[model samples]
Target: MIKFGLLWHKISLYASLLWHKISFCGIKFGLKLNISLLWKIWDYCNQATFNEVVYHQRTISSFLKVVFKEVDSNFAKLGTTNNSWFDYLILRRIGVETRAAPPPSMIEVHWWPPVGPWMKVNTDGSALGAPGSIAAGRVYRDHRGWVRGCFHFKRGLGFAFETELLAVIYVITIAHHKDWRHLWLEADLAYVVRLLNSHSLDIPWRFLASWKWTLRLLQDLRLQVSHIYREGNNVADLMVNRDCSEGWWPYALDEIKHAVALDMSTYSIIRIKY
Candidate 1:
C-alpha cells in the first residue's frame, strides 16, 4: 500500500509539471495570436494531445482562449486591416511591456513659430538666487511662418530683471547676425519692457549702460520692442526652462529631433503650418 501511495505521489508530481508546460505553451500561442501569429499557434495546437490541450485550458487557458477568439474574429471581420503582421506583433508587445514596465521619463519640447519676412521675436529669462544662476531664451519667427532659430544664454547669479535685460540683449545680437529688420520684440516682463521704452534710464542706468550699446545696435537695424503677457510667451519660456538643464543645447534648434522624439507625424506638421 505504501509503495502504491508513493507511485501515486510521483504521478501527481509529473501531472503538475506536464500541466505547467501545456499552460505555458497556450500562453505563448495566445501572445503570438495577438501579433497575427495564428498559423504558428495552429501548427502547435495540431501536434498537441487532447490531455495537453485540456490542461492548457484549465490554467489561464480560458483567458487565452478568449483573447485568441476575439483577435481571430476581429481579423476576419476587418478583412483588410491596415496594420502589417509585424506592426500588430509590435503593438501587442508594446502594450504588454508597458504594463510590466516602469513609467517612462518625461521629456519636454518647446514649440516656436516659423521664420520669414516681418518676423516677431519672443524672449524669456530665469534666475535662481540659491544657485546664483541666470538663463535667457529668445525665438525668432518670420512672416512667411518658420522658426529661424532659438538662442539661450546662462550667466552666474544675478537679479531677475538683469536676466530679463540679458534676454533682450541676446535677441538684439541674433537680429544683428541675421540682419533682420523691422523686428517686433515681445517679453512677459512689464517693467523691463517699460525700461527699454523709457526715455531716461533711472536707477537701472548702471545696468542699462551695456543695453545702450544693444539699443544703438537695434536703432541701426530698425527694431521695435514690445511687452506681451506671460501666457502668450510659452514657447520662449519652455526654451529658458529647458536651457537651465545640461545637454539641452545640442538639440536646441533641431526641429527634426523634436518631431521624431515627440512622435509627431507629418500631418501634425501640416496642421501646425510648420
Candidate 2:
C-alpha cells in the first residue's frame, strides 16, 4: 500500500509539471494550446515511472514535433525569443528558469592585469586520476606582466582539490620567502578561492596542515585571492600540464616566455555567445 501511494504521488507531480510547462509556453508564445494535446501529454508523463524521465523524454519530444509541424507558425523561431514547450518542461525538471537569453555583454569575461605594484600569482593543479599522481603549478607575474617566479611541482597520490590546496600553500611560501607583502593570488577553482577568502577552519583532515600553514602566511602578507576563468589562467594551466621530475625547482619566467607572451596578447576581450 505504501509503495502504491508513493507511485501515485510521483505520477501526480509529473502531471503537474507537464501542465505547467504547456501553459507557460502557450502564454509566452501567444499560441492557442490544444487542450486535447495537453491532456495526452499529461497522461503519458503520468504513466512513466519516477526514474524514467530520460527514457520517456523521447516520446514527449516526438509528440511535440508533430504538434509543432501542424501549428506552422514558426514556433521554432519562438525558441530563440522564448522557451519552447518541450524545453520549458525540461528546464523545470532541472530547476532552471524559463527565460530569454541574456545579452552578450552579460556573459563577457575579461582578464585584467594586476593593478599598481601588486603581484598576481595564478595557480592551477592537475591529476591523472583522483588518487593518482598530482601536480600543482603557479605563475607569479608583476603589474608590468613580468614573470617573477613559476614552478610545477610533482605531488604524488592525491585528488584534484588536494593539489589545488597544495599549490596555494606552496605559492604562499614563496611569497613569504621573498618577503612580498602586497600580492594578488588567482586560481581557477572557485571552492579553493572561497576557502582562502573565508579562512574557514572546517576542512578535510588531510589538508589541515597545509590550511594552517596558509593562514599563518596570510598573517604577515597583504594578499587577495580570487577566482578566474580557465581562459584567463593559461600560463598556470600550462605549468599544471608539464611533467616534473623529482626535486624539480621553480623555473624563471624566461623559460616560459613564449607562452606567456601569447597569453598576454590574447587575454583581453573574451567574447562568449549564448
Candidate 3:
C-alpha cells in the first residue's frame, strides 16, 4: 500500500507539470484560461500530495476529466493536434467539432433625448491637423427629435479646443437671436462643457470676445449645457466634416439627412453577451 501511494504521488506531480507547460503555451499565444479552474486544479494537486488515498486508474482518469472540463474548448482545439490525447478525449465527449464562442461585441450608447419639451443642440468642431484649418458645426433638434436647423463654418486658423468652444458660442448666439428660450446645449469636448456649465470667464485671450458675448446671451435664457460621448454627437460630427461652409439647416442636404437618419436609428440600446 505504501509503494502504491508513493507511485501515485509521482504520477500526480508529473500530471501537474504537464498542465503547467500546456497552460503556459496557451497564454503565450494570448489564450486566457479560466482562473477559478486553475486554482481548483492547484488545490486538488496539493491535496493529492498530502492525502493517503491509494493510486488507481479510475482516480487518475477522473482527475484528468476535471482539469480538461475547466479548459476553454476553443483554445484546447487550437493547442492540440487531432491525434493528441486531449483532442481524442474532447471528441469522444462532445462528438464532431465544437467551435469556440465568438468575441463579445462592444457596448455602444448613443444619443439620449433631452428632458421635457425643450430644444436641444448637439455641437462639435474639428481641426484638420490640430491647428492647420478649422471647422465648427451644430445640429438643432426639438423635443420630438426633429431637425430644427444645422450650421457649419470655415473658421480659418485655430486650435481644436478653441474651435470646440467657438462652436458652442455660435449655437448659443443663434439660439438667442431666434429667442429660443428653453435650450439644451450638448458637446463632446469636456473642457468646452465645463466652461459653459461653470459660466467661467477665465479662457484664452483670443476666445474672450466670443466667450463674453456667449455669457451675455446666456443671462436671459433657460439654458442647460452638458457633455456627451463622441458617438452620440454623430450628426454634429458629420456637419463639421462636410464640404459646405454653411446652410446644412432644415437638413435639406441629402448626405446630411442620411447621416441624421442613421444617427437617430442608432439611439436604440444594444446588449452584448460573452
Candidate 4:
C-alpha cells in the first residue's frame, strides 16, 4: 500500500512539472491570456518532487530552446529597448535578485616586498605492473626568495632516471611556449640535476640528449638548473600523486604542470631545498 502511494505521488509530480513547462513556454512566447492561472501552475511546479524534476530534463531542455528562440525574435523586433524582458525572465530562471544597498566602504591594505622570478620543476614516475616507483619535485625561486614554479613527476617503470629527464623535457616545453627568457630549474634528483648542470659524467646519454635539446631551445634565454631535497617539493609531489592515482591523460597532466610552472615563474623567485 505504501509503495502504491509513493508511485501515485511520483505520477502527480511528473504531471505538475510537465504542466509548468508548458505554461512557462506559453507565457514567455507572449501567449497573452490567463496570467494568474499560469502563475498558480508555475508555483505548483516549483513545489514538485526532485525525482519528477530529473525525469523532466528532456522536456525542460526543449522548453528552454523554444523560449530562447522566442526571446531572440522579440529582441529583433524590439531592439535594445527590450532589455527588461531579459532581465526579468533570465534572472528569475536562475533565482538572482538585487535588494538592499551597501553601507559606506572601509579600506584595508597589506603589503609585502616584491620577490624575483624563478621556475621550479617537480617530476615523479610510476612503473606499470610493479610496486617500484620514483618521483621528484623541484622549486625555482628568484633572488628575492619568491617561488617561480613547482614541478612533480612519477614513474612506475624501472627507468626512474629517464622519467626525471622527461620531467625536464616537459618543463622546457612549457618554458618555450611561454617565451621565458631566464629560468632556474630545481629538482630533488641529485644525479639528474648534476647531469643537467654538467657536473656529473655517470648519467645516461639519453638524459644528456634531452638536456642538450632543452638547452638548445633555451639558448636565447638564461637558464640555471639545480638540485633540492624531496620534502621541499611537496606541491608538485601531490600533483604527481593525484595524476598517477586518477590516471590523468599525459596532455592534461602536462597542461596542469606547465600552468603551475609558468604562473610561478612569472610571479615570484624563491627556491627552497627539501
Top candidate when judged by lDDT against the true structure: 3
Better of 1 and 4 by lDDT: 1
- Of the candidates numbered 2 and 3, which has the greater lDDT value? 3
Q: Superposing all C-alpha atoms, what RMSD in Å does each candidate have to the true structure? A: 16.7, 11.3, 12.2, 19.7
* Candidate with better TM-score, 2 vs 4: 2
Please give the lDDT score for candidate 3: 0.69
Please list the C-alpha lDDT of all candidates, in the order they appear: 0.54, 0.68, 0.69, 0.48
Question: Lowest summed lDDT over 10 consecutive residues: which window, candidate 3?
Answer: 93-102
lDDT of 1 at 171: 72
lDDT of 4: 0.48
**In candidate 2, how many Å is residue 272 off?**
3.0
Q: How many backbone clashes does candidate 3 have?
A: 0
Superposition error at 122 for model 4 (Å): 3.8
The true-versus-predicted C-alpha distance at residue 73 of model 3, in Å, is: 34
TM-score, every prediction = 0.46, 0.60, 0.58, 0.38
What stretches of model 1 exceed 4 Å from their correct place? Answer: 1-116, 130-132, 203-206, 243-274
Task: Give me the overall lDDT of model 1.
Answer: 0.54
How would you encode candidate 4's per-residue C-alpha lDDT over 1-274 as one tens digit per residue?
Answer: 1233443454344333333333423345444422433563364355443334323444434444454344445444332212244334543453323122223453322112122454434444434434356554443334554445545556555566666666777777777766666666666677667766774445577567666667688666667765545544544555655544433232324535454454435443344322
lDDT of 3 by residue, 1-274 (tens): 3345565564455355335435434563333444444554456556657774445545555655555544535355554323345544443553334333346676665776665668899999988785769898888888667788888888787789988878888888888987788899988898988888889887889889878988998997898888777766778888888885575466535657866676667554454644
